[model samples]
Target: MRSRSLVVPAVLAGLLAGSVADPASAHEQVSTPSAAVVGAAPASRVTAGWTLVARYGFDGGRPTPIADESGKGHTLRLVTRNGGTVSAVRHGIGHALRFPGKCLTGRRCPHAALQSPSAPNLNPGTRPISYGAKVLLSPSQTSKGQNVVQKGYSATSSQYKLQVDGAAGRASCVLVGARPGIKLITSTVSVADGTWHTVECRRTARALTVLVDGAVRGNRAIQPGLSVANDRPLSIGGKGAYSDNDQFQGTLDDVWVRVG
Candidate 1:
């Protein structure tokens, strides 16, 4: 209802030119570890083998109540400060949520973020996990480093976080826990050039890997003795545990998480 009057920009159209994808066909998993990446979600194609745990298909033209289409009701709330606005526009997949970069940009910067209630799947204990999202960032938008999606928000915090450092044009996926040390892998590939790209993180039993557009960009070996279970809610478009400090300045679509 709030999105009926929104106008899509021409440049955003260019950035989102692609065949629209249908929703993923995965149901509740069988619980025996069937795949390597996850389910058959259009967004999780590359990070194969894991099962679908949650999916925030923000295809809804509005930001609040981001629906989880994984058949599990892990719905996310569109949190805001002072009732700021978070807009949506046509993305390649359908509609994508946008966030403001900083404090004084007229858009919903740190004031608005998407959050889901804390769930067990989000706190994957000593298990492999994979998650991904389709994202876009304009050249002029300026947020030094923003998190695309995360379970933990701060330095030395929870399960994991996927970040896009706009200033560096790089992405990093990190898993933090005391049991096995931290697994940090970064991608040298740039994703801030106003184009649509898929960014993903895969944490297996023996290694952690970060991928950009289906290619492995960063990887590191680690033990499988970590427990990321915490009370923090899963968040997108901002750091969940950090009070939305690193609000993402761009658009996000087709977010999925699979806990192996």
Candidate 2:
């Protein structure tokens, strides 16, 4: 599958990680899990299975996905970014899926909870994160939040993901403060809708790989150094900052974090 070009005007802004001291930071302070708890699995254990990390049902005015009417499937994927195009498929017609977007108040909505004391801040000057998809209808209401889960951070490391959103566009996922120190791996081709899209990020001592749906989409290498809290709460549906109101406006289901 090849990617299509979708004109997505950058709108929303990016969130900046902050420096704080608290319990959340304690857990996420170091590159690896602590040794205090013996026989305990490392932080990498979180992503062991297709864990249900965050889910949205699009109910309660929250930016979550509601259960499908037919209770069958609810997801879409894009396989390529060649022409900057993406596609979203609806399973069991009549059901709606929520995509993340800026709020009507010119602000990002609220979705996840932050555990860090000095969580990052969302800047309004940044571009809006774009997703490629055909809006079926103007949802009577939409969500204004996102779910964020952070694993232990290391100066040399990578991450993995199993994500499915409405469509595949130029800017589906946004990485803030991601420089030569930090790398993000994601899928290039969208997955078949109404099913699960498994993606992974492997940050070896050298480069990074973004697996789309199942195949690799992007690959690059760079020197790395990232400052992240070890005990920070792996937030879901929202950023770590309790102050910022930027939330993911979509539905998330089955999230898992583990060591590569």
- Which one wins on TM-score? 1
Kindly report which residue stretches of model 2 are placed more than 4 angstroms away from their true locations once superposed. Answer: 1-102, 107-110, 114-148, 151-180, 184-196, 223-229, 241-246
Writing each residue's lDDT as its tens digit, candidate 1 over 107-157 gives 343445667778876788788888889888866664556767777533335
The Cα error of candidate 1 at residue 25, in Å, is 39
Provide TM-scores for the models: 0.74, 0.37
Query: What overall lDDT goes with each candidate model?
Result: 0.64, 0.29
Native-referenced Cα lDDT, model 2:
0.29
Residue-pair clashes per candidate = 10, 76
User: What would the per-residue lDDT of candidate 2 be over residues 83-139, giving only the tens digit for each residue?
Assistant: 111112232322233334334543233323322221122111121111112222223
